[model samples]
Target: MTLLSLSGVSFAYAAGKTVLHGIDLAVRDGGNLGIVGESGSGKTTLLKLLLGLERASAGTVSFRGAPLDARDRGFMLGFRRSVQAVFQDPYSSLDPRQRVSDIVAEPLRSLKIGTDIAEAVAQALRDVDLPPDAAGRYPHEFSGGQRQRIAIARAIVARPALIVADEVVSALDLTTRTRIIDLMRALSTRTTFVVVSHDIALVALLCERLVVLEKGRIVEEGATREILARPSHPYTQRLLASTPRMPARG
Candidate 1:
């Protein structure tokens, strides 16, 4: 079953420059998928379409088989609760003024998903392997890895069905990156993820399926293992060659 999908979608900026071509994609329910591409490959624009932040210029972006309608309060409320996102820079993604507790609880307050926001915040902190005391601290108090974990905790605090992670670990160091990847791997058992990254290797660690985007169109897509072993497209081959291969999931 598909939770969110883009059918023949396209997008262009006001300058009349097309960023994405006719594109078709689906995010299967409870499954992890990766959208991989070089910079300016339309990957970020596609993520915006999936998140319903930007409307498609040509085709449909659907949630659960119905067109995504931002004006429909009933539909949008549900969509907001069902899909959540974690962006690239943990340092900038978080509010410097908000305490960790309030930061994590923002979704609960905005979406009104749970009654006990405090307990939910604490539980989310636990899920991310942070100490309970960490919640009372500000964003400046933690290391980069810890800050990213806080961001992840906030994303999962609502127990949303799907998470769209966009270049989530790109800003972290190598040692920190591995630990966060491991944390996400553990979290994947209970939540579906759509990971967007320039690194084939990072997405290979998280996504069961892979979609390659180049110049605003899909160049190739298939099971991650199959694509890793035998890439059929020149663009995809280059992506694989550019990144060190991470150990595949068993």
Candidate 2:
């Protein structure tokens, strides 16, 4: 089933400054999709549209076969519950003042899920390979990778159906990046993922299908391996050539 879709979607910041144009895309339930582009490619803008942070100037955005309706409280609430996001820069994404438990439980509190919030938080931490006691600490107490793990914990606490991750590992070191990617890969078994990144190789690791954008429009969309092997667009070829190759695992 199609969980999220954009048809003929176009967006503009102002009367003249259009950011995205005629974009059509969709993700099936439990699908893993990657949106890849460099800065100014409208990747983030497209993400904003998908998240309902911005509305399209020209097309339709739909979730579960229904058009996105911000005015409909019921639809908005259900959409919020079904879709969750993990952003780039875990250090900044997490609150420094809030305890880890509170950070992870915020979604549950806001969504009013009715389950035991404490148990959900604890399970989220454990799922991310963090110890139970880590919940009592602040975001600053952990390493970069651990902090990202905490952020992941927060994202998964609600058992969201779709996860939109934007540049999630761009700020981490190689070792930490690999570990986080592996963690996300494992999580994909139970969740649909929309991974947005400038790093094509990293996206290749997590997403089976990829959509390459340039100048605010999709330049190529296909299977990850096919695109990697035979890029049809000049921009895609450049993107692939410029991205550093991932190191071989032992």
Candidate 3:
């Protein structure tokens, strides 16, 4: 079943300059979709629209066939609980002063999911392979990969149906990047993921389908194999060419 759908979506900044036009995309339940494009391609904007952080200038964005409007407090709260976001920078996204447990428990408190705050935080840390004691430590104590794992754990703590992972692994080192990607793949068995990234190979490794964007338009999209093996669109080809190659395993 389709968990999220965007139809004929268009968005423009003030002064009538359109950034996205006639965009249509659907993400199935538990689907891993990777959206790739150059810096100005509106990938992040699409994510904002999905998260209800920004409304579409035109067209509609829906979840479970129902429109997503942040004005409805009930729906907004429910959406926030069911749909979560793990931002690009873990260090920036988290509060430096707060302990790890409080950071993970913030969503539950805000959404008022349940009273078992301690249990929720503990299970979340464990789900991401973080030690129970790690919950008491601050963000500074963990490495980059570990911090990102905490971020992911925070996203899923409420049992969100969909998680918008915006560049969740981009800032990590190559070794950390691979490990985090593996962790994400393992986690997707339960929660849906919309992985926003510009790295073709990273997306190729993680996503089931690919959406190639250029200048705010979807230039091409298809199964991961087709897009990677023979990228038809010029923009897609450029993205693939620009990727830094990692040494093949022996």
Return the top candidate by TM-score: 1
lDDT by residue (tens digit), candidate 3, 135-183: 8999999998999999998999999999988988889998999899888
The alpha-carbon RMSD values of the candidates against the true structure, listed in the order shown, are 0.9, 1.8, 2.2
Rank order (by lDDT, best first) = 1, 2, 3
Q: Stretches of candidate 2 above 4 Å error?
A: 246-250
Candidate 1 has its poorest 10 consecutive residues by lDDT at: 241-250
**Better-scoring candidate (lDDT), 1 or 3:** 1
Badly placed stretches (over 4 Å) of model 3 are 244-250
Better of 1 and 2 by lDDT: 1
Model 1 misplaced stretches (Cα beyond 4 Å) = none
Give RMSD (Å) of candidate 3 vs. truth.
Answer: 2.2
2 against 3, candidate with superior TM-score: 2
Q: Which one wins by lDDT: 2 or 3?
A: 2
- 1 or 3, which is superior by TM-score? 1
